[model samples]
Target: MKWYSLMPGILLLGLAGCQNFPALYSSAKPQITTEKIEQLSEYGAKFATEYNRAAQKTCTKYTRLYQQGDWRAGWVLALQVSATNNKHCLDNTAAIQILETLESQKKIDPELLWLTQVHLNWLKELEQQTKSVSQLKRAANRKQSRVNELVKENQDLVEKLEALKAIETSINQ
Candidate 1:
């Protein structure tokens, strides 16, 4: 009677062992479900909208400062605007591309990738220009320092020549 009662449990254990449990758990890669992709894409769109609004505000601030003759402040604001714009725009676009790729179950579209790359290139160019401008400002400061030193040296030479003339006259007298 006890053996009969344990038979079902033994059968269940045998069946479980026969099942391909490891194959179910092991995959080449984890895949995102369609629902999750859609949810994340929606979030990306909302983030882009918020970022756009923030970029507009920064741009307005930059323009205001520039017009008010505070150019350094304006430049700083402009850089901030550019970086923010780059993040939101690229993230939004990339999210769309990824969603499309996963939806179609295909490889990534190079054209869509290029679209994001172009914006990145532009940001790089902007950064390079800022660096160049900074270098020029530093060079100008160095040149100004040299000019000040030359002016002081000329004054010292003039005073010394006058003192030598006075000394010569006193000795002769």
Candidate 2:
């Protein structure tokens, strides 16, 4: 038989074996109905919107501090904001635990999965923002240190110049 013909035969055999698979369908009762699905979907949409808005507010506040040259405060605030945003994200392991709890209680709301996904994305963005804030602070610190060194060097030079002039006057006298 040709390779292509034999390939189709093997594929059919594999599919036939999977026909009686019970794992694809659960025998569990309290199956999720269309009504529950709709309710969960609505809940998830609402939660995502509200959670994102809160996260955006925190980000904006932190950004303002960053712009104002408050590196220390900005760095701390950025971390806090990231933590707060992380709490709201869907990808959190704790949130998965909560889902397990809900499932065990038979109180699983499909909206939760959606919430976890939304929160996960927000946390990622917050993390990136935090890194940017940290880098900016480091750069600012470097610039400040350089300025201080220059000021000190200028002061030392001025003192040496005054002493040299005084020595010349004594030699002449």
lDDT of each: 0.54, 0.55
Check candidate 1 and list the clashing pairs: none
Task: Please give the RMSD to the true structure for each candidate, in Å.
Answer: 17.0, 13.2
Query: Tens-digit lDDT track for model 1 on 65-161?
Result: 5457653332233223345334422233333333343325433233233433554456556657878999999999999999999999999999999
After TM-score superposition, what is the CA distance of residue 89 in candidate 2 from its true location, in Å? 14
Off by over 4 Å in 1: 1-112, 169-173
Query: What would the C-alpha RMSD of candidate 2 be, to one decimal place?
Result: 13.2
Q: Which parts of model 2 are misplaced by more than 4 Å?
A: 1-109
Measured with C-alpha atoms, the lDDT of residue 40 in candidate 2 is 46
How many angstroms is residue 135 displaced in model 2 relative to the true structure, after the best TM-score fit? 1.3
